[model samples]
Target: NLASQLTISKSQPIISGIDDIKNGKVPGNRIGLLVGSASLEYYLTAVSGGNPNYYPLYSRDQIYQNLLGNKIDVGFIDTGNAEYMTNDVYCNLTIAGSGFN
Candidate 1:
């Protein structure tokens, strides 16, 4: 799980590619991009088109908690952490696509 991708709750539909992201067909639009993370580009370019209205999480725990709590619908994270978090620590989440480096 060395790649990176969008992570969403199992309750949401899986997004198979970047087209889904750009088309507003993601796991719900309430995105949580951690401040200062590389994921910001995705949120702004793919999700918001530079609107900056997406939810801004401050930490890894905060992002996971928000997703689990339904405060946010999705997050962008490294696939390694995404795998461990979803498969081992939290079973209700999943990577949205095949992931990229």
Candidate 2:
């Protein structure tokens, strides 16, 4: 029952769609995922066709911080967390895509 959403920093090149990620247009090493979330990890791997470049983050706040700092180019977060991050003043993130359980 894990739903996830893709987000990127406002400064990143606009990702037109999910195809960019699947085709390896997006740098693999720059993708971030929650450290302990098995579902997020699995989804990233499955979507990327088994390419493993997803960085494991400590928490949702860390994901936001790393993304804003350009430490990571993209991140997968809980859908609800994505909504909050997008609306929060401190987090300048854009919704790139969404996936459901």
Candidate 3:
């Protein structure tokens, strides 16, 4: 049921897209994520079957800046925050799609 839900909707699965995933030059890409957030930790665990490399930012604003400047390829943010972030000028980030991290 969880897997089905993840595949079907953007609500529960909380996925982010890789620029490389859409473009042809590269295949899979790394996703930036928050260190303390349980959702991020869960996604990381699920993807790697263990912990993986993640960049820890001090503030959400810092993460927004990084996303804007392209320092990090992509990030996993909650859907509620995602809406605001996309609308924010500093980030100007967009939701690429829906899937598990």
Candidate 4:
């Protein structure tokens, strides 16, 4: 319930890389978050770090593809899924630093 916890309480801030949310640099000044991603729903959104400005993606694969293609600035994938996506041969995506654990 960290997302809920953080969503309710906005004291602690969720820090992200500048590149992920810079004006006009990132699409819509928003990052893609998985609606079903527990970490993103709780952690990333808790402090309004990466709140949804657009629509949420159902599958991690979609997030991965959007991120790699620069359609979305960033996304929240499980650490495991991040690893898997990073290993994809077709991807040229780079992780935004220090957003998640």
| Top candidate by TM-score | 2
Q: What are the lDDT scores of the predictions, listed in order?
A: 0.75, 0.74, 0.47, 0.48
Estimate, for each residue in 1-101, the C-alpha lDDT of model 1 and write its tens digit: 23567787888665665567668765344777788777776567656778777788889888889988988877878777888988899888877877764
TM-score of each: 0.80, 0.81, 0.59, 0.56
Model with the higher TM-score, candidate 3 or 4? 3
Of the candidates numbered 2 and 4, which has the greater lDDT value?
Answer: 2
List model 4 lDDT by residue over 8-82, tens digit each.
001212324533343334443345766766755553444355645543777866776665555665565565555
Weakest lDDT window of 10 consecutive positions for candidate 1: 21-30
Q: After superposition, how far is residue 37 of candidate 4 from its true place, in Å?
A: 1.7
lDDT of 1: 0.75
lDDT over C-alpha atoms for residue 63 of model 2: 83
On lDDT, who's better, 2 or 3? 2
* TM-score, structure 1 vs. true: 0.80
> Which order, best to worst by TM-score?
2, 1, 3, 4
RMSD over all Cα atoms, model 1: 2.8
Better of 1 and 4 by lDDT: 1
Off by over 4 Å in 2: none
What's the candidate order when arranged by decreasing lDDT? 1, 2, 4, 3
How displaced is residue 35 in candidate 4, in Å? Answer: 1.3
**Residue pairs in collision within model 2:** none
* Candidate 2 C-alpha lDDT tens digits along 1-101: 67777788877755755667677777777888787686455655566666556787888888888888888887877778788868875456888865644
